[model samples]
Target: MASVYKSLSKTNGSKEDGPANGVKKNKQRVLILSSRGITYRHRHLLNDLASLLPHGRKDAKLDTKSKLYQLNELAELYNCNNVFFFEARKGKDLYLWMSKAPNGPTVKMHMQNLHTMEELHFTGNCLKGSRPILSFDSKFDTEPHLRVLKELFLHIFGVPKGARKSKPFVDHVMGFTLADGKIWIRNYQINETEASKVTSADVEEGLKKKEKRDKTGGGKETEISLVEIGPRFVLTPIVIQEGSFGGPIIYENKEFVSPNQVRSEIRLKKAGRYNARAEQGIERLAKKGELGLRTSGGRAPKKDELDTAELFA
Candidate 1:
């Protein structure tokens, strides 16, 4: 097993480098994890990893765009047995990969969301079998998040479930950025008694107080952050071009496709051509790149799916 290193290329390109043999000291295998549909975010992680690697180190870099066959080939080419897996989402796919790669070095890269360190620790413990390590960078306040995260780590790794006793195995390396742009790394240990005080009750009471203030007209609604609104998911526009009928469509599966489809059932009415036009309009508004068509029983449409008389009216 060799040490994994970041991809370094000034042109910002992805290409395999080094010899074809199965033994090399300068080459290491790494996996970049991210939301399946979002390649741009994956690129950001690549760039960040490149920047973090020690300068002037002779190392091989493999991006996720590289096919699995290619990665295996590179592994064999470099005699590489070690793997580094990076996680950027809360999704379960990363855990699946980690479970499959039990013999490799797995690292989880996390974004600083609102819950911050607490979420990170939860994820780390949930994927404890992965032997996970974490890296986070965000504009959010770190002190509170760090404290919460540290407590979670202690709770998961040191304190046994349903027990009042704490273990001494908790240790961590923390890095913080200062107001002057300097970064500092510090060693720390967790104090369980203090950490346990930060429970769900404390958070619920705080929220209750906020609600009471809002009801009494003590605070403005606009002050609340949009993150408190609801659930969030990434939406990507898919474009499909064919002849002169190029248009956009929404891809619900997050898989990329080409050319949009106009539902034939909607196109069957006496005035149903307008349905295609309306779909085109929606595609334009949504900036969709790919379209999906729903058909029934290998037939275009039946009387139930569309009403011819109503369409004409």
Candidate 2:
């Protein structure tokens, strides 16, 4: 009937190469913009990312590495709703994420700055939300650079100084470090602490260790217990449907080399250079007749027959 044909046409138009469930099957599309570190390993990583999400696909032809301004334009052109931007600069790494959905904008960003292992102790511990605290091991009571890094972190986390008294300010702890000429970023969760009464032998020993005399001239001592809380994780660079933080990497250090890939480029280049030297060596040896042993080691002895007289005797 005419009605059946109309129904079939509509279904076919909305059909996707997926399951035949009752829901509409439009493929999930994501756009990745990167160039500096693109390699076979990265491609495999991107493919892995796509596989994590159900029905996700990556458009390999369209690349938007340095072209951030045209994000929206190319996204619409390619009909991709999710996009990720990655970059590296001077041992620092940056990441940015944006969505081209109809409702509203979704953006997330992460950065890793360079730092020495000894300089990580200054941040101390986290005292807020159910996230862990990520602190450096170095004490920077006088280090000016540490101060600057702390200030930069204020843009992404922490509540205003004035409003903290009214509403408790507690959130995740974000930090960075520089290693292998690249900056690495990490996120942590700081959880609340609940006080508990302790009376164990170990607790008593700890109490003795932390005993403090009263300043009031009273012959009394006080002991305090400390509890360490917080869980930490290294945030990888691969773009995901949604990560711990909802931001993308818009900026990164230049000297940064992403993970899961080897630094064999230099070796490959050196191999090319050595190729010419090898050819030159071959020519030199040929001229000297070293490799041309057939000519120098004496024309390989003429094809003389065996002593037939000796064999007959």
TM-score for each candidate, following the candidate numbering? 0.23, 0.31
Off by over 4 Å in 2: 1-152, 158-171, 177-182, 192-264, 267-292, 296-313
Model 2 lDDT, residue 109, Cα: 36
lDDT of 2 at 139: 34
Best by lDDT: 2
lDDT tens digits, residue span 1-313, model 2:
9999999987876574234557553333455554454444334434433332222234543344455446556556766555544443322343444443332233433433322222343232443322223444243223443333333233223232222122244434545554433224454333222223334422434543334212222223323322222122233223322221233443333433553233467767788899999999877766656434555542344433566665566
lDDT of 2: 0.40
Worst 10 residues of 1 by lDDT: 225-234
Alpha carbon lDDT of each predicted model: 0.29, 0.40
Instruction: Please give the range of 10 consecutive residues that has the lowest summed lDDT in model 2.
Output: 225-234
For candidate 1, report its TM-score: 0.23
- Candidate 1 Cα errors over 4 Å, as ranges: 1-40, 44-67, 76-191, 195-313
For every candidate in turn, the CA RMSD to the true structure comes to 22.3, 18.7
